[model samples]
Target: MFLAFFLIGLCIFYFYSIKKFVFFSQKSIKHDPPVPIFGNHVQVAFGRRTQTEVFNSLYKRYPSEKIVGYYKGTKPEFLVRDPEIIKHVLNTNFSEFCNRGVRRDPKVEPLMLNMFSEDGSVWKLLRHNLSPAFSGSKLKSMFPIIVSCTNKLVTVAKELALEGKEFDACILCARFTIDLVGASGFGIDMNTINNEQSLFLKLRELMFIKSNWQMFLYGIHDLFPESFIKKIHISRPQVRLIIKQILDSVRSQRTNDTNPRNDFINLLLELGKVGKISGESLETDANGKYKEMEMDFNDDHIIAQLFIFFMAGFETSSTTMSYAMHKLAFHPEIQQEVQREIDKSLAKHNNKLCYESVSEMVLLELIVKECLRLFPPAGYTSRISSNDCVLPDVNVEIKKGTKIIIPIQGIQLDPVYFENPEQFNPKRFLHETLQPRHKYAYIPFGEGPRKCIGARLGTLETMAGLAAVLNKFDIKTSPSSTRNIHPNRAAYLIQFIDGGLPLRLTLREKSSVISNGFP
Candidate 1:
């Protein structure tokens, strides 16, 4: 009798799981056929293909369709291809697709409660409060902190150039950005640029190396948010303990301070002192009226924000700078043009790398923008519908809880929108050239309200770091470097180079030439 009952239950489960494979068929939307439990993401789930590759394949396959349907396990997902649909999802009908749909149990993983992972009311409130911290004035005030880090980077680059060493640009830029985050975000000197064995660097490395079992656990959690997967811990206990200890130590030192330091930690501390984060409501009631809402800004919330700040701040900026260096190495003439612009700008600033000087390096900025277009740090972003709605231009009805993916990399590389999309062309970003393009076509920092708050800061850091290096030294492709870069299949959301980016460095002869107007 027990055996008969078990067989009955197994049959029921099998049909129930496979039922979702027909989701797109019923909706009349095009999609790849899904298997029972793996859904359409079999390649990604089994590690045969990275998420970016899978998404790109689906995007290319359905050229005529505005949206392509897929499944993550049993959950239905929509991959949006039309720029109009994307704009609607990101801006026009934002209320219906506001959340990123990344649910996290605050009790199990306190750090996951950050603004980046948060949904709905909590995200709105936190974003409102945190927006001021990244304002123009605040970033300008923090410029000196970034300059100090850049100075250290220049010192290390000179030593590397003098020794005629071939180094991985990926690791080199990561160390520089890590040091910037340490000083600017937490008001601590990590000295990672000089100290190869820094504890913080080890922690950063460990965060990216997830075990196979851990990846399975994350998949389970993503597919079955209401199931027993909540009990599974996504983060390592040792890492959490170490991060908490660091936060506690820093908090204790700043608790009694009256003067504001204007750093990220101090900014959060100030917001916490206010007790609650209030904002205009994004949600409307049945009566069609918006109401004000507030969320508590407690210690856990503060720690969560700080954690994301450090993670996003360092990772995105460093990856961008590394890729920029890689591109410049291959294109020597472009590199020379960028260096000339940097020198001209610095000459006006008395040979100092200041905010005003960096702002004047237009060609350098264009080069970084082009690098981002080719290799966006966050290749794709998703949004889940909060209510049943029709997409603006396509008029496709989307059900509540359905996931929508915006393929930033695919859109940026699509030849339909960009001419010779594979070629590294910085001129595409020139003001007049950019004016005619679709606004949503190039979204490295994403679009609409949920766009990365650290966009400006990240750009500043990348340009500043590049300027500092190019001003003193020249980058060249090393024998260990690969002409064709491949993305790491195992990497998390960020698209990392398959292997480290290796490059050789040499001091620029123009470094000794002082401009007539500057010291």
Candidate 2:
């Protein structure tokens, strides 16, 4: 029968493939015991552990090895432990490891063509176009709007302080961030805190919908290429509607505006115009002189880039701010010290917090760094091989399709990298004693060319928001807080732990108005 022959052929192919890797292997590193098929992912199936925990365990098990090999379903995965090899993969021989390793065919999944999934030449070109948009000058231009959003957040916090005398700062912080993203990214004031049914909030809900079925489908898609094509799809109809609305508004506004607002949406509109009038690719001369390149910038490109920026700008920074508040609540002494610094800085000025004053807040910068170390926004990062390459010390070759992850959470918590890594010590960053830490050890925003494009803007927004909150009230941990934070495993990229960082906020005797010099 044809069915019998097909089954026999599949068995033969599977057996031969396994034998090619397991029996007649090119090279292999001894990894912690792996199960058949799922390998280390078996722990993930029962909810007994997370990918981060698995990676951390492997790191400890093979501390001496530069690269440890494991399998994510039959596919080989490299758990890169050595910083030297990590640097090579991320920087030195980057071409060989340029891809993010996610397989989402843009034709089949048109929405997946954003920065996170694109690879090689396509990634380079897209990254180049997007990078220039978020320069320091651009962020400075958007500072006032960010401050205004914070003002609204502080007002809400003040009301909550009066009502219950204590509240969850994380909730207020997240709400403020969501509002800021809507206003700054799309040039639309969402007022998410006041308007519960805002379109922006609805879009956010869709983004974080943690259904087990959705996770299972995505996991299957990640592990097995064949299943990815046939998996049940999850659609964000609300998000699509919001994007369509914004895009249409932006397009119309771009035509009418004599003087446009200095925000992301306006910049995108201008870029879209450039593509319309000119072309997509920049032209060059035979003599290497500047000439106009010609490729049309389509709606898809514009929408995709803007959507990515909105998602990145809001979520990552908000998560960082949340964790910082959580730690500050529990460690009141540190909170008091930070408040004193904010006070001293404000006292220098006529008592107004402005753009320039924020830059000069060195202590605030150190605190932010410490916060990033403890609760890195994007906990871990993975890269796929663009071509065959070998790690620095190891003879093992990483073939194309290999997934390499840098465990940011594990590295940040390693005592070897930080003294008492578990402790909430802001001073560890301030103090330059004991031992020198590795540069790549704390990659909160990642490193090299593919580093977070909006890192500066994200950090500035967070600092501005925190400064606004601290000026109005003193915060401490509520008794209902958790002792140790555990991530909601269902979500990706960010970790919002259980209990949601409840905190007690007492109104300050007087609100401090620090005049930051530069306008």
TM-score of 2: 0.89
Candidate 2 versus truth, CA RMSD in Å, comes to 3.9
Q: 1-519, model 1: which lDDT tens digit per residue?
A: 999999999788779989767877887889887888778877777666778878888888988888999888888888999998899999888888899987668888887789999998888888888888789998898888888888788888878889989998988898999999988888888899998788877777666655687778767765676799887778666666666777788888877867657788887877788877787777778888877887778788887887788778998899999999999999999999888888888888888888999999999999888998999989899999999988866677888988899988988989877889899989888854546888898899999989999999999999999988898889999888887898877677678787979998998887624332112
Tens-digit lDDT string for candidate 2 (73-111):
666778787777778877787767777766366555455
* Sliding window of 10 residues with minimal summed lDDT for model 2: 276-285
lDDT of each: 0.84, 0.71
* Candidate 1: pairs in clash: none
For model 1, how big is the CA root-mean-square deviation?
Answer: 2.6
What is the alpha-carbon lDDT of model 1 when measured against the actual structure? Answer: 0.84
TM-scores, one per candidate:
0.94, 0.89
